[model samples]
Target: MQYKTVELVIEGKTATLFLNRAESMNAMNIKMIDEITKALKEVAASSVNLLFITGKGRVFSSGGDLKTMLSSTDESMFHPVMDQIKNMIVTLYTMKAVTVSFINGAAAGLGLSLALACDYVKLEKSAKVAMNFINIGLVPDGGGHFFLKKRLGEHKAKQIIWEGKSIPANDALQLGIVDEIYEGDIEEQLTFMKTKMEARPIQAMIASKMIYSTQELQHLVETLNLETMNQLEMRNTEDHREGVAAFLEKRIPHFSGK
Candidate 1:
């Protein structure tokens, strides 16, 4: 199916979904969320057992469309946006295919969350990442908190989230956030991954992914709802307003606890 914000390319048994909005650094918006969920559902029902998700151009995703959200005057629109994001994350996390994230560039905020939801993540050496929700006076959404703590343990995860630091690809590789960091040609890297997945038992891999997700991600739905509420409250705060203003103005944000 055709999509405005995303592109789905199928080659034989392998499928690649490219985040297509390069102009905005592939920032995810409501329409993109809807398209992604629809595409994931389609792939889940298809014979394609391997799925690759990556971004177009310079960034993997700059996260939620902060510019759009901050500019909107309607509070009513926020809830549905978070809901769409939640549904998209849930769909990706629980999909039957063996999902992999190819992080070609920066992954921050909700972008990090989405990448972490995949079964495997590969990155280029120059790729960048951050869980920077706190920078905007927002809590991590899209299961970011859960995925981080699950991988890095509670103490380290809390430090990264609280500090809102951008991590280099080598650091991320050492931290185990990504499966591998490649310095070679992108096409070669993708070809290698495709071959690797093809060699594995597809059904067994899918079954293992499902079982692990069922046990580890049991609280995802509940957490997503809670994140929605928290983010809504944060959005109405003076600090969030300041953060957005500061971001757009390219200045330091002075957030008060209001």
Candidate 2:
């Protein structure tokens, strides 16, 4: 498929997928999610042994499209987008290509989840990341729960998710969230890592990834479905409305238990 929101490049045994909506901070709109899903599928089915995922602009991704959120009135508006996100995340999680994510700047909410889905996650030294769904009275989707628990265990993962605070790159690395924290250009680091992986037994690496990913696939699917259901319910709450209002108006949300 022709992609507008994502750019997919295929080179010898390596593929790079860029989140292309820089003006919007590469927000995960339906088009971006669909494009990513299709691109990942193509990479998985081809000769690509390594995949690099990164954003095109200063920030990795701001999160879901807030403009879309403002116009959404019901589950119909939410379901397809959520499902597309789920598909994209699942594809990235299970793909045969050894995937790497370069977080050049901020990665929040679903963006963080996308980074965490990759086999290796690298962050620029000053970059920050957050599972910030709580800020908007929502929960993390896109297999956020699944990946976090795997990396951080249930207790730490729950604390991170519930706090919804932006974590600095060093803090995130110490917390075991990101694999590496780099000082130089993340693009340069990504290129170096890709070359390193290409020299190794890529198929052997792919086999190991397949085994672990297969074992965890069912849990990830359940998490995605649960996130979808809960997000739809959250959309119906008064607090969600308040949160969106506060965000748009640049004020703190006054969330009352209604």
Best by TM-score: 2
- Root-mean-square deviation (CA) per prediction: 1.3, 1.1
Query: Over the stretch 98-212, how does candidate 1's per-residue lDDT look in tens digits?
Result: 9999888899998889999898888878988999988878889998888887789989989999889899998998997788887776667778989987888889989988998
Best by lDDT: 2
Per-model CA lDDT versus the true structure: 0.86, 0.89
RMSD of 2: 1.1
Which digits, one per residue and each the tens of the lDDT, describe model 2 over residues 1-258? 578999999989889899999999998877787888999999988988899999998888988888877776676778888888888888999998899999988999988999999999989898999999988888898889888999999999999998999999989999999999888876678789877886899999999999999998998999999999998888888888888899999999999965
Candidate 2: C-alpha lDDT: 0.89
**Candidate 1 steric clashes:** 0
> lDDT value for candidate 1?
0.86
Model 2 TM-score (2 dp):
0.97
What lDDT score is found at residue 120 in candidate 2?
92
